[model samples]
Every structure is written in C-alpha cells, then in structure tokens.
Target chain A: MAKHSFSLSPLSSFILPRGDTLFYLIALFSILSLLIHHLSPVSAESRHFEGFDADEIDDFGDSDEPISAAKHIPPPPPTTTLSVSDPIESHHGPPPPSADPTSQVTSQPSDPKPASTSFEVWDEDEFEGIPQSPPSDSPLITESDTAASAESDPSLKLEPESEPESPKSISSYTVEIVCVSFLIMFVINYFTGKKENEKLALAWASKFATKDSIFDKNFSLLGVGETDDSPLLLKEGQNVFKFYASGRRFCQGLLATMELKSRHDLISRLYNMVVPCKDEITFEVYMNDDAMDHVVVAVAKKKLAKTMQKETTDLQRFASLVSPPSGKKWIAEELAVVAESKEVAGDMLNETVLDQVFGDKAYEKFGKGFISMHFSDQHLGSHKKMLVFKFALPDAKNMADMTRLVALVPYYIDLIGRYKLSSHARTKTDGARMKVAQEIYKELQNARQEALQRKKAEQRKKGEEAEAKLSAEALRKKEAKERARQMKKAMPKMKMTRTG
Target chain B: MSSPANDPRQPSTAKPYKPSPVAPQDLPIDYSGFIAVICGVFGAMFRYKICSWLAIIFSAQSLANMRNMENDLKQISMAMMFGIMGLMTNYLGVGPRGSKKT
Candidate 1:
C-alpha cells in the first residue's frame, strides 16, 4: 500500500497543477463571455422569458385565494381517479382537489367541465411547481426540468423582483469601465497637449522672430505674401516649428527648428515620466565656401561634449579635446572644448563674448538652457562649412529669458564671417586635414584589397569542395579529359578530314 | 567705425545682400511608419494578433531605410511599444473573444 501510494504521488503532483490552471482559465473565460453576452442588446428569447415570468407570477398570486378555499372541500371520486392515472400528474395530483372548486365555480357545474378545466390549470402549475417543490417525490426529473428552464432563461428575474441586487451585476463590468476610461484619458490629453505646444511655439516666434527683433535685423524672413505682415514662423508638425532666414552676410541660409517632446501621445507621456528629457531647438546655418577658414571648434556641457565627439562624424575625425592658452584659465569647470588647434579655440572663445555670455554671473542665468555649439569648416555631408547651436527651451511663460542666447546667433555669424586665420595657424590646420584625408584613402584601399582576396579564396574553396564530392571514377574521367585538352593545345592545330 | 551709408564721401546707394539660391531637398513623410503606429495602437486596444504582427513588419521596414534618426526613432519606439503590448495581451492575457468561445 505504501509503494502504491508513493507511485501515485508523482502522478498526482504532475497532473494536478496543469489541470488546476486549465480549469481556472476556462472558468475565467466563461465568466467573461457570459458578462459580455448579457451586456449586449436584449435578444428575442430574453424578452419572451421576461414577459412569461411576469405573467406567471401574477397568475399564481390570483389563484392562491381559490386554492386555499378549495382545500376545505371534500375531494370528488372522479378527480381522485384521474390523479392516479398519470405518475407526473399524481406527484402534484393531490393539489388537483384544491384546483377543482375554482374550475367548478368559474366555468361550469358539469363534471366533465370541472375535470377538463382542472387539467389545463395543473399543466401550467407544473412548470411553476418545478422550482417550488425541491423535496418532491422524483428529484432527478424535477431538477433536470428546472435546470433546462433556467438555462433557456437568464437569472435576471431577481433584477425585477428586487432593486438592491442590480448593483451586484454592475460590479462584474469593471474591465469594460477601465478600458473606456483609458480611451477617454488618451483623447483628452492628445488635444490639450497639441494646443499647448502650438501656443508655446507662437509665443517664441512673436518674442524673438518678428519685425525689428534680433532675427529680423540680421537675417531676412521670407514672406509668403507680398506684404511683410505674413507669419514669421511656419508650423511644420504638431510639435515642430521652423523659421527659414536668408540674406545674411556670410551664410547662405539659416534654418531654425524647434523640436518639442511628443506630449500628444499617451505612450510617449508615460515613457517620459520614467526617462526624463528636455525639448530643444537647433540652428543650422550654412556658410559660403570662402567665408570660413580651416577651423573646427565645439564647446558644450562636459557630458554632452563627450557624446558629440563620439557621435559626430566631422568632430570624431577632425577635432580633439584641447587645453586653454598657457596663462588663461579654462572657460568654466562645467564646460568642455574640442578643437583642431589651440588658436581656433582661443579665437572662438574671446574675452568680450565670455564676459557677456559664459562668465560666472551670466552662466548662472543661461547655463541650464545652453546645450552645445559646433562650428566646423570641414563638416561632412552636402554642406561643408556649417554652424550648429542647440539650446533647451524653457516654459512659454519664461520666453524672454533666452534673449542673450538668441542674440549670439547673429553675433557669431558676423564674427566668424569677418574673421581670418593667422598665417601660422592656417598652415598647421591645412597640413592636419591633408593627413586625415590620406589616412582615409589608405583605409579604403586596404578594404578593397581584402575584399578581392576573400573572393579569390572563396572560388578556390568551391573548386576543392566540388572535387571532394566527386567519385573516384568520375574524378579519373575529369582528369583524363583535362589532359586530352592540354595535349591538343600543346600540338599545333591540324586539319582533320572525316570519312563516312 | 563709420557706416557706409553714413559716410558723406561714399555713394548713397549700396546693394542689399542677396543670398545665392540653393536647391531644396524636401524629406518625404514616412507614411508606413505612421501606419505602423496606428495599427499597433489598435492591436493593443482590441487585441488583434494580425495587426500587431503587421505593425512589427512595417516598423522594421521603416527602420531599414530611415533618413532622419532623431524623428524616426521616436515614431519607431511608439510603434514597437504598442506592438509588443498587443502581443502580450493577446497571447499572455485571456486572448480574443472569438478564440475564447472556441
């Protein structure tokens, strides 16, 4: 017995968990489907059941008076004989005597009339009796009949009978309520967020980009209409605004794009809560070929400066971190610089600009908003000489805080456009660029050579594999055919005559 | 420094700066990427496996030929989130209503 019990333990443990999970899953699924089915529009069968239950309950209430009155009267012999004829009728046949007086008084005094009327009332009462008599003589038959009727009709009878029990059914619809609430929240956030972003962008444009503003005096804002009263900014997307300015002294054009976070999307809003980010505006100024000398300089926050050097193609190839001039202290402890040479860094970060913009007092006011500034003459891609400035946007209420930073765009545009490299610095920059170009060319050539060699080796391997796969007899035949071809080539070409 | 316009000795007329015209290269909108995001959102909300799988496929195609990294990355991430959410809800949750009835 112990051995048998031990053997059964493994089987029970293995089968029980799976069986339990399946059973629970099926139960949950059925419950969910039933809830959905009931919540749908009322069907014909449900309407029929509702009307039938209401009428049946009223009829039973009216018949109760007659049933009580007939109980005192003596039972007729004919009614008793009819009750004993059928087993199903006999189960409720004792109640027939009570129904007989109601049929006799309401319909006719004839004996056949009483019997026929009594049978008709008892047939309807049989359906009602199934639920009423749980302890009847034949429970199996009654239980099966009650279950079949219950399956056809919903258990919603209690809903009309009692008002307080309706809340129990409502509690089961929590899933649908939650899903609908989420959809509502998403829609509300989308429209409100879009309007807010548009308001911020328009505020920025009105403050810094309109007529007589810093941008208007330095660069031309092309108007859509003939008049200058046209809008100064173009709304490109929900969160992106663009300002195109041309007619500057040294640059071809300036494209300023403000890229805000996707506040309109619910998923993006949720993601932003976990991983914090900032909205930024970038300036891309394309310079004329002769406007800039050989200089590549970048100044940024220490953390971002490292990323720029790693990610930017031109910065990675042409610039490296540089120290300040011998007697001068670095720009700021929080700042980092990457440049081709020390002179370019010095020329770019001069005394006047430093005191007005990046000094300790000014840095405190504007440092948080300032992200990075990169100026490169040998920048890769279509435009070789370019200037890029990135700044974080403050809230719309504080739009005036960035006046000094915005002014720097035109200031640097004029400074770099008019400035020229020293003779000594120019020679060094030219030589460095030439060396980088030569190294890139050499790398390309080496890659091509390696590819060619790889192809040759692949071909040789294929030939060997084919030979190895051949049978001995097939290999001999191939070799003999090759030998015959070689001998034919070795001998001088001879004219051959075929005789038939 | 004297302004050229202010100098009496110089001519009053000075040419206004006219920038050289450059060709415009307008980037086309990524319709497939946007479709993927919409499909993914529907899939997650309605628990549709086919829509979720289509979102993933369109996202891959969008990523392969991406031109702008910053903008494309944001759209791609949103699509991926909805697609994965849809798959998790369909396979790992109670599944679709039709499948449950079967």
Candidate 2:
C-alpha cells in the first residue's frame, strides 16, 4: 500500500504541475531543431542558377520564337511598304506589285531608325536586340560609341535602375505596414481591455455596496464647501447632481464634510491606525492588498470620479459597524479617511502616502454630475481645518440610492474608527459572534420599524385633524345660515311696519 | 557438477571497468546556445519579427549563461554572434534573398 501510494503521488504531482513539462518540451524541440540545422548544413545549390544555356533553351523554344522570327524577316519589308503606300495610294491606283516590293526593299535599310521603332511597336523583346541592329549594319561603329548613346538615352537606363530598387522598397514597406497595423491593434485592444477591467471591478465592488434593481432618477453633483481646485462645475452649496439626470447613466457615491482642528494627513493616519488590526479583521469589500499603494487624493473628471460609488438603501446589507454602500461603482478620485497622530509608527509612513492622503479639492476637479464634496477653510472658524470625504459612482442611474449612500459616510467612518480602536472587541466564540451580530441586526430592524410606525402615526394624525377642520367649517357655515334666515325674517317684519 | 571455477573454459572476472553515464562538462554542446541559434535561423527564414525578437532575447540569455554553463567558450561566442546578427538582419528583411537562409 505504501509503495502504491508513493507511485500515485509521483503521477499526481506530474499531472498537477503542467507548466514545467510544457516548458521542458519547448526547450527540447528547440534544441533538437538546432542540432539538426548544425549537423546537416543547408547548401545554397538549390537556389543557384545551373547555367545561362538552360535559360536560352527554354526561352527560345516556347515564348520567344515569334519575337526572333519577326525580327529577321517581316519587320523591315512591311514597315517600308507601309511608308511608301501612304504617298502612292493617295496619288493613283495601287502601285504595281513588281515596283512596290523593289522600292520597299531599297527604302528599308536607308530608314533604319523608323524600321527599328516600328519593330519595337510590333514586339517589345525585338527592340532589345535592335541596339545591336545598328551595330550589325556597320561593325566599324565603335563599341564605346554605342555604349555612350545607350547611356545617353534616359528611358533605356531607367528600367534597369528601377528593377533593383523594387525589392528593397517592398521589404521596407512590409516592415512599416506590419508595425503600424500592430500598433493600431494594440492601442485598440488596450482601451477595450481597460474598459472591460473597469466593468469587472465595478461588479466586484457591487458585492460590498448597493444592488438596486429599479433604475432611479435625480443623479447630481452637490458642492459641499470651498476649494481652489474642485472637480464639480458648480458654486459652493450648489447642487449639480440632478441637472443631467434625464440623459445620464446612473451613479452613486458617499460624501462627508467635516472640520479638522489642524492641517494634517488625516487619511494616512487612519490607514496607519487600521494597519495594526488589519490581520484580525478586514474590510475586504472596500480594501484590496493594493489599496495601500492606491490611496491618492487628486483631481479627476466627473465620469471618472463617480466610478466606485455605491447604491443606497434604508437597510444594512452587511452586519458590520460601517454599512458599506449597497453596490459600488468605480471611484475615479483617491480617498483618504482622516486621522491625526503626533509620531510615525514605522517605515510604512512614507511621504508618498501622506501626499496622497490629504488636501484634495473634490468639487472643482470633477465636473458637474460628479460625486462632488469639498472642505471649507473660512467656515472652520474655531476649528483648524475642514475635511470633505466623497465617493463617486461611475454610471449611477438612481439619485435616491446615491444620496442614501452619501448620507451613510459619516456613520461608516465612525463605525470603522470604532472597530479599529477596539481591535479585541469581537466575541470569543463563533456562536457568541453570531448572537451579537443577530442582536445588532434585530435592533436595527426594530429602529426601522419604529420609524415607519411613527411616520404612519403622524400621517394618520394629520388626516384626522384635516377631517375635523372640514366638519367644523361646515358647522360654522350652517350656523351662520340659520342666523341670517332668522335676521331676514325679523328685518322683513320691521320693514312692513315702517313701509319697508 | 559444472563448477565454473574448476572449468578450464571459464574466464576469470577481476574488477571489470565501469563507464560513466554522463557526458563531460567541457563539451561544446550548449543546449541553450544552440536553441537560440535555431530560433534566429527560423525567424530570419520566415521573416517573423516576433520570432526574431525571441531569438534576440534567447541569445541574450545564452550570453549571460556563458559565464556559468560548462560549454566551449569559442562555440558559445560564435553562436551568440550569429544569433544577434540573424535577429537584426531578419528584422530588416534584406539578408541573402529576404533572409531565406535557413
């Protein structure tokens, strides 16, 4: 049994770790191909031309025989006769054949230039040999003279020069075309992949936040305070969230504005405070391993800022102290939860983190319809400074859901802070933990029920009061009618006595 | 009754020699270098830019391994040189008939 188990283990391991085997095979094949390439060298004999005589045999028998035959016999005689007939045929009846042939034969050699040009028109290959035709007519003509004239003719030289240059240009063009096409495809693919990743991230965030089926209206960017650099395209205290609600995609976010006593990197401090307790408990939905590196406060576009906002609802989805928003959208802005500490804890507290954590203008940086919030300096009369926390959803359709999430930001921060401070506050056992969570859930449910009941009672009271007022008014009108009738009867009697 | 020690025809065994199974360290065959050279050849032959780049990358790796691996120094250097040349020329598409020299 032991041997069998050990044998099975090897098999399982080999099957499980497939990547190693694949790499090994690839390396083996490459080495094999190389050895084959080296041991049996490829010769250039397959590519080399055997001899020029072979080309002559193939060229002469098939495609070029007519060109050769036309060169020697018919080109000269026909061309000369055609030239003579133009003058003779116009003057009188067709010249006698006897005189015509003799006259054409004499005229052919005299006008060699026209004869050669006409032969070239009949067949292109025939013109190639015509250069030698002039030389053949009188061998005394020097070789250097013919060469000079051939060089002088620009058309003759253009063909050979252009042919050699073609292959070089084609290769270059292929490289350029492949590179350009690949670049275009890469750019397009990158953008599409980025968009797909954002969508996936949003879906993952939604598990922690709100998930409302009904698409709501009234999405807007509300300016909370004053800032030099703001994402919102609005004045202080202005609400631009719902202006484009009709034509806009739905987005949700959390925005918190508070006053701070002094200028500090509050968000970094909060992160540091939580770092100690991160092992015991985790905000897995809002926090990733990379979140430590990603905490940044910067100006972003409205669409980008509201990418990670969550939908809002009355009830808490998760039984945590901080009720994370219903569903999350991609938040374009970097958010920092504010905290203040006198001394640094470890090397973790770096300058980059501090710069990323505090002092961001959420309103002006993001445009209208963004999840816009800001901190006011002048408004902090007694306090040192103000903190404005905002969360933006990418494509939020419902305004009510976003507003609800925004309303929960303060509670979320307070609960999160509380959890961080009392790391040992959790129950000892799983059963105990469950009981505590259930008790809290029950309490929240009770509170919600109580609030609903109170609203119903108030509405009932208002209805009763309105009904009473209506009946009392009717009674007063009836009483007045009775009194006027009585007064009218008395006035009539009095008018009768005084000739009324 | 057929005792080998007593038999006149039996041959005596006196510590037979055992041969080593593994090859010597100083052999010129470096698998990594040869693989790189092969990649360069195929890439140049097919005019594949990506493969040429692969050849360049593998050749760089081979060069780095030259210090550690037990390959002949001359052969390794030659392979590296050829690999690099093949990569660049193949990428340009102008070596000996559009880099068709496999």
Candidate 3:
C-alpha cells in the first residue's frame, strides 16, 4: 500500500510569497509617507497668510510716508522723532499688540486720524515712560496708542497680520490628526477581520469533517495526489470549502460546498448587520442520465418556493405548485412543494419522511435552517439531471445537531435513484417535454429563415448600389444588355428551316 | 438462496464507480473578480481614492476566496495591478487640479 501523507503544503504553494511581501512593504511605505506629509512642520507653516512680508510693509511705509511728510511739515524733525520712537515702542509694546491686537486694530481702523504730528508727539512721550510702567498695564495703553498710531502710521500693519494666521494653523492641525487616526483604524480593522473569518472556517471544518466522520465514510476525501490523512474538507477560497463524493451507485459524484458570509470585509459585515443573511452549505449531485425517470420536484421554505419555481429553468418549464393531499398539511406547514405532478410529490414526501420532518427532535428544532432541496432529471445545464440540497449552516457548537439533516443527502440519493415514475405519470411528463422541444425547434427554424432572408436582401441591395455608382455609358450598356436578354427570351421559338 | 456459480443467472462482475473529471468549461465564472478589475480601472482613470481603496479590498477578497487557480489567477492579478496603480496615482501623483498651492 502507498503511504498517505497529509499536509497543507499544497494550499500554501498557491500563495506568491514575494509578491505579497512586496505589496505589503509598498503599502506600509505609502501610509508612512502620507502620515509624515500631513504632520510635517512645512505643511503646518504653509497655512499661514502669505500676502505680505515685513520688508514689503516697511517699503510701503517708507515710500508712502515721505510723500505725506514732505507735503505737511519739515521732514527732518518728524523723521528723527519717528526713527527714535519706532524702536522703543516696538520693543516695549510688542506684547500688548500680540495680546489684544484684534480688538484695538478693529477700533483704531475706524477712528479718524486728526494729525500725524500729534501721533508723533504722543509716541515720544509714551516711549519716555515705557520702562517705568509694569508689563501688564503697558499692553492696554500700548494697544490703544498703537491703534491710534496705526491710523496715522502704516508701519503698524505687521502686528495685525499675525493675528489671522493663528486660527488657520490650529484648524489644519486638527484635520491632520483626524486623517492619521482614520488610517490607523482602517489598518487595524482589516487585519483583525481577516483573522476572525479564517478562525470561523477552521472551526466549522474541525467540528463536522473529522476522520471516520459521516462525510469520510461516504465520500472519497483523497484527491489524485493527496495522502490518506490529507484534510477532508478542502479550503478552496476564504469563505468556501469543498468535499467531493465518488463511488456512489447512482450519481457521478457529489460536490458539497460551504459558502460563508464575507465577514472579513468591514463594509460587508456592517451591511449584513443591517440586512441579515445566512451561511449555507450546498450539495450538488449530478446523476447518470438513466438513473432516474422524468421528474422535476423541489421542496423549499414557503417564502423561497415561489422564487425557486420562477428562477429555475426546469421548474419554470415543467413543474407547477403542488398543494398537499386532501386534508393534511404539507411535510410541514413551513414547507412548500413544486412538482411536475402530484404523484411524484407523493412519492417524494411519503408518510415516513413526513413523520420524521414533523417529529419533535430534528426539523422542529432547526426548521429555519432548512433552505431548499431540488431534484430534476430535465435540468437545462451541461449536467442535465441533478439533485441539489441547500441548508443554512448553524454555528460551530450546534454543528452536530444538524446530523439528521445531513444524513438525508445519502438517503435521498439512493431513494431517488431507484424511484420509477408510474406509466401514466411518465407519459404526461414525456408529452409536456415533447411539446416544449417542438416549441424550441420552431423558434430556431424561424430564426434561421429570417437570417437567410436578411442575407439575400443585403446582397440584392449591394448589387443595386454597385449599379448606381456606374458611369452613364456603362448604365446604358447594362440596360441594353438586359433588354437584349429579355428580347432573346421573349422571341418565339422558330423551326421554319426544318419545315420541309 | 442458490449459489451464483451453480445458478448462472446473476451477473458475475461488479465494477466500482469512479466519477469522471470535471471539464474546464463547466467551471463557474468569477463575477466578483471581474467587478474588482472594472472598479480598479475606473478608480485609476478617474483618480477616485475611495474607489481605488475599495478595488484593493475587493481584489484581496477575491484572491483569498478563489476556487480554481488557473481560471481565477488572470482576473485576480489584473484587479490587483489596477488597484495598486489607482492607489499610487491618486496618492503619489500630482493633484487633479495641478500642483499644490505654495
């Protein structure tokens, strides 16, 4: 006997290690750069007002004041007093302007400037007493004096410029903080959510598909190159697992897939919370063509039965809603049936099955978890005949409780494979299928005929278009040739030379 | 019950069933992976940061959950490439309005 080795090396081999590592490194670099860009001092300072610089302000003051000073009074005395007072006031009164500059500037800009000489005289007196006053008292008097001076003097504009910039810088700082926090939150959610989804899938597989389990007993868990101990439930994708069953009598094989919700994605998780959905396990068994008689039957939850009938191709073509026999309810009140005829429904939902479904233990407790089951020998796809069962998966802890439901798969496979439709019911289904086949045939014939006619018409139109494009002489010659041919055909048959 | 060798009525051979391999044409199409690629391209062309991010996430989801490696790899790779391109262009490229204000 060949040795059986079981490992997840095959699964890991599919991952591109270098690609993933490079991708993560690039992502990390981009994120770090984004954070640095936002929090950097250069970006913070850019938010400040850029309209005017101190030199420009000084240039404006120097250029404008001399014109006024030259016109109003002798420039030398005021220049000397202004130069001497400017430095002292700036040093002594800078704190006052910084503290309450906005209010004073707003008030001072409104006040009328009576005389430039008066402002100069007041500045000189204020500078002389500046050192004697306390620091706190100086700001109030200094602000008022500056505001008054600013109205007469242009150089004082620099103090108010810094005021507006403070508010802008603070607002930008708050925005940067918000962006950094959001990036961190997104990264954290992504990794944690991914781990949570993987754990859920692993837990479900461990609980239901161990060695010597029902699945292992019935199905061939080992694939072509896999070992005896290889995991029975193959993880095909993040939320999907597949188990293959072969060596069955009637069906080719059963492909069972467990499809879980997208819990790893934060947005999808939130959406699922708002609109509830379930994780489902689906079993698709393709039966051999001759294994079953002509039949299409589906049993589903009452709410989904209508939709199943509408959407499924075979159900839409051959089956209709089958109400329960005379007085008794369906297999369960919650269940609905759609079948080709009442006879097949009876055969499918017989007394034993009905009793088990209605019994207190299995279906009654986990009834809602039963989604739908469909059987059709006339299915439309590549595998024409199939049996499909879909059930909502319960949580990992309660996985064992659904054993009864899972057992139904093998039981139904055998039962349905051996089932033979009565002669009368078989004829009715055959007639219905024959009628549909004829309808499809007629539709195909009509389409082919239409295409042929369209092609011929297109050829004729192209010939006429070519004729229209000819020169006048060519048109005349073509018409004459047509006339001659008609004349030759129209001429009477002559046998006068052989009359003798 | 009569012995089968003596009776000569029952069939002698019994063959175990082995299922035929699934054909490539029968595999289900990966619709989510296709959608991810489309979103990725639109994100890159339009410079929509949100769309770019969504494309990256969707690509990862598709890649992690793929069923058939041969069938799904091309689509997953295309989606991932476009997603990365979109992110790089939207973040590292100059603003859609031109250079940033000095």
Q: Candidate 2 regions off by >4 Å?
A: A1-22, A25-167, A170-316, A319-500, B1-102
Report, to 2 decimal places, the DockQ of model 1: 0.06
Give a tens-digit lDDT track for model 1, residues B1-102: 111232111112212223234332456687768988888878777777777766765565455434455446557766766676666665556432221110
lDDT score for residue A141 of model 1: 17
Q: What is the TM-score of chain A alone in each candidate?
A: 0.61, 0.21, 0.65
The C-alpha stretches of model 1 lying farther than 4 A from their native spots are A1-170, A221-231, A270-275, A326-330, A366-368, A453-481, A489-500, B1-102
RMSD of 3: 13.4
Q: Which pairs of residues collide in model 3? A: A238-B65
Question: Could you give candidate 1's per-residue lDDT for residues A51-160 as a string of tens digits?
Answer: 24454544433332222333223333332322222234556335444333212322112222224322233335435423222111111112323445655776411111
Error of 1 at A328 (Å): 3.7
Indicate the residue-level lDDT of A26 in model 1.
61
TM-score of chain B of each: 0.67, 0.48, 0.71
Tell me, by DockQ, which candidate is best. 3
Better of 1 and 2 by DockQ: 1
DockQ of each candidate, alpha-carbon based: 0.06, 0.01, 0.11
Pick by lDDT: which candidate is best? 1
Model 3 alpha-carbon miss at residue A80, Å: 26
Q: What is the lDDT of residue A454 in candidate 1?
A: 100
